[model samples]
Target chain A: MARKLASEDLTPVAGGGLLHRRLFLKAGLVLATAQTATSLRAEEVAATTPRAKPEDPADPSWIHKPGLPFTGYGTPSKYEKHVVRNIGGNRTPQGDGVSWTPLEELEGIVTPSGLHFERHHDGVPDIDPAVHRLVIHGLVQRPLEFTVANLLRYPMRSRFLFIECGGNSNAGWHEEPIQRPAGSFHGLVSCSEWTGVPLSLLLDEAGVDPKASWVIAEGADAGLLNVSLPLSKLMDDAMVGLYQNGERVRPENGYPLRLIVPGWEGITNVKWLRRLHVTDAPAMTRNETAKYTELLPSGKARMFTFVMDAKSLITSPSPGQKMHGANVYEIRGLAWSGRGKISKVEVSADGGKSWAEAELQDPVMSQCFTRFRSPWAWDGKAALLKSRATDETGYVQPERDVLIKERGREGYFHYNAIVCWAVDEDGTISHVYA
Target chain B: MSMLRCVAALMIAVSVASLAVAEEDTRVKGHIDGAHGSAAVEPAASANMRLGTPLTSDDIAKWDRTIFPDGRGLPPGRGSAKEGRVIYEQKCARCHGEHGEGGTSEELVSGPTPPSPDNPSKAIGSYWPYATTIFDFVRRSMPPAAPGSLSADETYAVTAYLLAANAIIPESAEMNAETLAAVRMPNRDGFIWIDVKK
Candidate 1:
């Protein structure tokens, strides 16, 4: 009586797919047939069973007790304590490394503020907002000094976007596949609703000099991290973000204020912003010249590569998770693009041999995380699962081999390729570069 | 009687036009009042509204510590590698190895060779594009324990020592704003702007 399910049968209708079953429940549709059947069965069971002891002390613990008092600030439930950022720092120096966002543990698009990924050069500086002042000088017609209060007075806009380190997912360039969870390997990117004043308005207030082309944005951290960004880009869509996720920005994520350049690399969105020096040329700072620059196969180093390309990753049933025997499971993952909105995400159960278009979650905004899902029926057979993303620019996420061929084997940053997870007959999953 | 009625009509029209002008003035006043009352309000003309205070030259100088590759912003100081060795032993050798071989922090000097596809060692001499970056970086952030604590002379000395140790410059060479800017790096032409092509 076993029969193979066709691809058409597996494909879900709009808003009526297996992935939207939870959404349907939230929509409040009653299951009349199941409810009536359950009621009749309950009637039969009540007639045969004895009356329960309602007044017994062991019946319930909180029956006659008052609940705990409310707290001013709330935290995640005790059961979710394990959901924390996976810290990966240098052995000698305490805070010289990076912490990854738990991407697999998160649901939907918005990554919580506390669990956002962190990348520190020296370490986080305890900056006082009152003492901190953002100075705009150099080639400007009139140099301006603004406090946090002055910045808050400007017209503000909120946007849901992702900030990804240029060095994120660099493990993919390794000779062999990394066996860690998806989050540990690729969680340097995080999404949030950032509220701030547009950089264009601030620049207009200062009146940028006609000759000024670049703006060197510097952070107030101990490292004095600085990088040069084109004034054209800052005037385009950059923001001086003051808040994150409906609250004041967290300490780890540039408390009080930060610069947010949508769809650009995270380093360009200088956290703990302190200065903006307009200039005719790039400063060619240490970060821009020495670090963050990639050496090409042609014996030339690629500099000022700011934009993060389109990428996707399948979170559930990834490495470190096991699949149950032969049932329909919802394959879920996240897709994002720096060029624009994610146009499509294709899931392939048999590696790259054939792919099916996955359903994208609602409110798929540009330069934001878009959740894509598909339902797959596993037959307890060995299979390879992979997801590839396509952005609005018609750029497809390349395969591991294709990416290696293009970028070369000496890659250290901006490693975005289709990730594959192999599912064995024993129901164990592991990373595979298919 | 007809002439009197026409005059009264003209008077009424004149009063209504004057009232309309008064109402327009009140609306403009209301806009100004709204902008003054709440900081959240968007003013009708942002060009007219002055928000931040204008910075003076001294105030700007305090935070403008950035140094360009052209040596335009280098502070006035001079030091030799010989003088730098003493300071290096006292302050830098603990974290950065005695010969800048690197212990806890990044190695300042490595083998006197450029990085290749096979053996990529991005040390100070082999990779950095500009010599002024050494002065800028050392002065801004060095001795991880206390950044921006080094004296101007100390920073220049350290820059000279690192440059000499990496075999980029002679040990006796004095480093200052002028000399450091003139010294061309080995990898000065190694970089290409990839964004320009895009």
Candidate 2:
């Protein structure tokens, strides 16, 4: 029998009504407890009962239906149309704009190809693959021009990685949390399975001169965007990606060809790439000089600080969301590091006073997304929840004040501090400096 | 009979002349229409044609768009600080500022120190490490709205003005492609190498 609730029962969680931040995994409180139970029963049946070999080829499940047909291109399921990147372009110029990926609504690591974030200075160029070519010139032993077909024939590997725009989270430098959705605040970053040939392979094919230490990568967009990358990184884990999320790259995300610099900002991973000019030194492009440079308190500027530090954020129970009741819940989110694998993720229910180790999902690849989960109990009390990720390099995420103090108040780019969420008595959640 | 014969001859001549004119009109119209048709679907235009003239070693013999950490990517042009001042007023002052100062939304010529845990200021004279970066950046994207539009000479003039304003280059010194590539920046050695040693 369900008891009628009084109006007073809907009181806030605490003074701020923030929910209990820690995942208090009580009995039977897994986020997917209902589904897990069924799977667990299936495992038990297989272990205890004698298994009989199936004689019939036309099983009931297979006889009635075959799988969906193949498609040249694919879109998200009908139920997932709401998960598209929140595109916002300039009213006058249709091509100039950005789209924020809905990070909070997604689960696990892979960001479906359709939902990858976009930051285009100019409009997306409709390039014909037939005529596309990648030219390697400048300080190389031999200049080579490879068509799209030639590039596809090279050996390739797949990696689950994240590419974040350098300007992302620049809004954090603003005075307030800029209330919106969690995605808008942190959506500029997205992770996907990128498959491509190693850039070193192509550079080797071009016979990079021994003195060539830098390469100027240029894109074919209207802006003719170009930037210089250290040859060391090019020879490292960098890839000339041809696929994203197990399919040919999307036009918005550098279809036909693109460069993937693992763990670096998105700008360096140029889209619609057309040329790479090996050079002895940096090109000092506008991106490296005028923009993406941070002002330090020590009377110096931090220019080519490329690697994105370890960062994590709780998605559900985040801002603009709420809790149902004093029931058990699953606290889940994603953590990643540009330097390497995420070592551990810690969650705090009462601000940063208490932290508990959350379970990291398996198949944790380097420079890839690592999903984390922990159980929590909401005792109808206000609580603050937060997540902090520590990378394999033993670099613990810094607090807001730490980052600000180190980088100075003028610092805007690479804003990766721990994120906190506060739940009110009415179960409404919002961003909090705590 | 003579009047009837004359009328028949006039009608035949008019018909033949009109037929010739119609043929000429069809040929002219067909050529004009074909010339203006959309080429996207036609696949006749070749993008592989060399852009501009073929650049050989000889053609690039004098073009020195290269930069080292010290100074580089400067084009073959020269400008005096005095000339730069006049150029700045006519071209740059509207957006940049009167005395190498910055405008709203534009970075000031002089600036903050390198980014660190404390003081964060970004400016050309104070923070930039290599003088070459300034030349590269100005040449690639600058003047706000009109990027890659400045002449090689104008680019050198603006670069000289900026360097002089930053107190790097002497006020009376001249900056050509060769001299510009020799100027040094304040924070040239102020970078932390990623310690991913094998």
Candidate 3:
């Protein structure tokens, strides 16, 4: 029997009282007082209990009343105050590592806008949007300059997509398992509803020269960051997003403007967008040359790999989550791809020894989030849970060892391998190689 | 019959005039750049910026050091291997290493080998399609922590050291605007024309 936090002297009942994470739809648990009442003999306690009958409903607690007014924007409930993106940096030093995103405490398809993850090379620059100017010069019939307000006047569209850091899941590449919640390992990727004007319109307005085949996109951060992208992709599905969720984007997520290349990794989508210079080829910036470029096992370095392949993760049944002894559990998670739609997702109960197809939720969108679920029965034995996504192009998610063998020990960027979580007999969960 | 024809002609003229007036009104709804017949106009604001304000031109420009595939952002800086060795240790070696071998989470130098379909390195001396990218990237996002803090002279010197270490440039060579732009990369000829069709 268990009691809630407040009702039990501000402390929850110890030892597996927390409900199984797989039970997502239930509001709360049954308390000990209610359970004891059912077990008690009715006649012995009837005189002292003085229980209110069903018809005695004249007065209800004022706390069970109507709530406050509506708001233009929304935030997470006060109960989720501890769920914040943890940022770590050296006080005297800068451009350091940051760990910790509270992935254990979230649910549903969309990540709340405020709790989206961040990784900064330099400190976040407090930019003045008024002074920000987007210059479109170099190899154009008519070079144009646009203020943020000018760009907003154009027609716009919205999409629900995810932006993932290239270095995400680097912990997976390690020899030993780095135990943490799913978010810290994969939180670098977050989904949002982005609204923006398509890149095709701006490219058309500038009148791209016939010889111009590559665009050198630059940002206005203190870094003055720049990288080259193929002109074809830039004009294809790229967007200059200004709004995330239903409101203007937060500063950490690129205030005023950012380039959103659907299905592409996050670095190519420059934030604090400032300039685009049309050119003949890639500038071959350090990021393109030395970094993001991976050396394959055959000794050939894979460069200019722009598209992010299909990937998915089971959020609820993942590691650091608890389980109640042997019952039915509903597996829930999200999947997406940059190439196109996820055609199918298969879940494994014994770590790929046996596979069962999971149910993909309705309204599956291209280059957007597709939630998946599967019903499972636990017979009180140790097992492993894993999911593999196959995209529309017939590319199946590779195993961890397969990716390592092909990419070699030198692999640093774009690690998209199947993830496995081992559930022990005692109901403890952890990352496993499987 | 003549009176009826005259009345019809008069009605046509009146309708045409009203249509012309409506078209004019819609076109000038926001601003009036030019004078049109019977259109309400907004007076133009007076200019404050005077004629003799110093022009910020590319001529005598300070920050034109953004090298592209066609070699545009390279600036005036010259350094030899002997001088570069000092600069490399003082500034770059803290992260990159003593022999340009690279540290953990850092990149190594040395490239210019042919695209190894069997084995690809993609280092400065190997798989880079253009040498100009090295100069451009170093000027922008190098040192990881302190980006865009290097001077033109430092960038050119560092690029020269990396090239020499990668065996592209000789030990005693010096690099400047003209010589740096002229340097070719190994994989420049390996690119395929992959673009989306309209």
Candidate topping TM-score: 1
**Which candidate leads in DockQ?**
1
Worst 10 residues of 3 chain A by lDDT: A31-40
Give the per-residue lDDT digits (tens) of candidate 1, residues A110-187: 999999999987788898999988889999878998888778756567999999999999999998899887889999
What is residue A281's positional error in candidate 2, in angstroms? 3.0
Model 1 chain A: ten consecutive residues of lowest lDDT: A29-38
TM-score of each: 0.84, 0.72, 0.74
Model 1 DockQ, alpha carbons vs. true complex: 0.25
CAPRI-style class, candidate 1: acceptable
User: What ranges in model 3 sit over 4 Å off?
Assistant: A1-75, A86-93, A96-102, B1-65, B97-130, B142-146, B184-198
Candidates, DockQ: 0.25, 0.08, 0.15
lDDT of 2 by residue, B11-99 (tens): 45554676667667767767976534221211111212111122355534433344554444445677777777787787667756788
Predict model 2's lDDT versus the native.
0.71
Give Cα distance to truth, residue B41, candidate 1, Å. Answer: 11
**Candidate 3 residues A1-434, lDDT tens each?**
34342333322111112222222223233322111111223335565777676333567554477887787666776744557876643332255445345555565556677877776665566878887767777777766677776666445678888787777777777898778777778777777899987777777767789999988888876667777788888887889899998888878777778899988877888888878878786677766665666666565566777778788887767776666666656666777787888889877878887676777877677777688866555555787888889889988889899988777765577888898888788666788998
- lDDT for each candidate structure: 0.80, 0.71, 0.68
CA shift of B154, model 3, Å: 2.4
How many Å off is the CA of B4 in candidate 3? 48
Better candidate by DockQ, 1 or 3: 1
Sort the candidates on TM-score, descending order.
1, 3, 2
What lDDT tens digits, residue by residue, belong to model 3 across residues B119-156? 45555677666767767776776655677777777777
* CA-based DockQ, model 2: 0.08
